[model samples]
Target: MLLQHAGIRPHPDYRRLMRALRLHAASPRGELAPEVYPADVANFFRRRRIPVAIVREGNTNALRKILAQVRRAPVMALVRGPEWGNEDHWIVLIGEERGMLVYLDPWYRPTQRYRRRMTNPVFALRWRGSAFSLSRGQAQSVRRA
Candidate 1:
């Protein structure tokens, strides 16, 4: 999704990379256990020469700071409970709407087919907020500064 947003198409091995990332899964205990390490996200982009700045587990205030500094849309992915699907969800943060955060939701399934959404910084219980914003690009950058 990030690559696409940056106008770069993934070469066909993306599925292999997703498997390697081990994103979205269930534990024997049947809890929400997605291994979405921010560094992993960063590493993938780094390989493509796209610098990514990861925001640690944080709150709306932290997000505000990121929104102010990002050159590209930030990727927000959070882990939710069973009621909210018990899987980690990812959204591309666009900007602010009214007082809410506006984002591009890439999820589309029989259960969830939401796209182009807006939400409160914290829309209730489920949020393990981890985000990564692409930094300002230099001459040899992927986003073609």
Candidate 2:
């Protein structure tokens, strides 16, 4: 993972982490965006012509609506890393199939610089119903070759 390779610790703040992830997405080559935040990600989606509907945080009613849309399409979760002090993390939740939570880990820019080459690739894993369970696994087998 770029995060791991970059040594950029995950932010504890879910909101901040999401923002960082969105910023990471702007650079396909793993460059960080000058300004990254939830709003940025939301705007990026909108500019790309992706439909976005903001829901109240932790709102069950809103969650249901979002989940319904996610089932029909891809849903990305901008969340905080377990160790992030207050920053949020960004994770894409494609769907629940075969008891797994498929997602993508976009590139991240860490404060520490490393000489090794790292490739940020999207993968899937079995959703264990917890943040920790969202492990990196092989890409969806269904993806085109």
Candidate 3:
């Protein structure tokens, strides 16, 4: 969806990745259960040769650096959603508009401002342009710049 919004064609290999993830399951109530780890999403992009910098959650200083980076490019992050009682959710940091970050959410039709529901992102994964650059560090640790 982010790729589509960015006017880029998604790689077909992503389909295989999603299938392997088993994103859907049958519940006792006959409902579809879908869940994906943030690592899975990061790995999916890694497999495609994208550079990724994983920043730790709650690090305001590091986060500010990342936010600044996104002002020049796009990024993907795992955050808590307003509707799901702050459940884990994925959103893309497309860019800034009128001094606000623009996000492409899978559950909504329109783009929303970063202040809406991204109140404390658990982590962030930044890539270089459409391609990602790999960073060295613990996946959950945000190194001081």
Candidate that would win on lDDT: 1
Report lDDT (Cα) of residue 7, candidate 2.
29
- Model 1 lDDT per residue over 1-145, tens place: 5554445543326555664455545656888556656666666666666655566555557655555643356555554656457776666666666666666555555367554444554533445657766532321334221
Poorest stretch of ten by lDDT in candidate 3: 136-145
Deviating ranges (above 4 Å) for candidate 1 = 7-12, 23-35, 58-61, 69-72, 79-83, 109-113, 116-118, 123-126, 135-145
TM-score for each model: 0.60, 0.40, 0.56
lDDT of each model, Cα atoms only?
Answer: 0.56, 0.40, 0.50
- Tell me the deviation in Å of residue 73 in model 1: 2.1
Please give the RMSD to the true structure for each candidate, in Å.
5.5, 14.3, 9.4
- The local distance difference test score of model 3 is 0.50
Span of ten consecutive residues with least summed lDDT in model 1: 136-145
Query: Model 3 TM-score?
Result: 0.56
- Give the per-residue lDDT of model 2 (tens digit) for 64-115: 5545655554555554533333355555555555544444555434444221
lDDT (Cα, tens digit) per residue for candidate 3, span 1-145: 3333333333345456455444654556777646666656666655554445665455556667667656655666656534545666666666666555666667665554333323223233322222222332213222221
Ranking by TM-score: 1, 3, 2
Residue pairs with backbone overlap in model 3: 50-132, 51-132, 51-133, 51-134, 52-133
Query: lDDT at 137 for candidate 2?
Result: 23
Q: Pick the winner on TM-score between candidates 1 and 2.
A: 1
Error of 1 at 15 (Å): 2.7
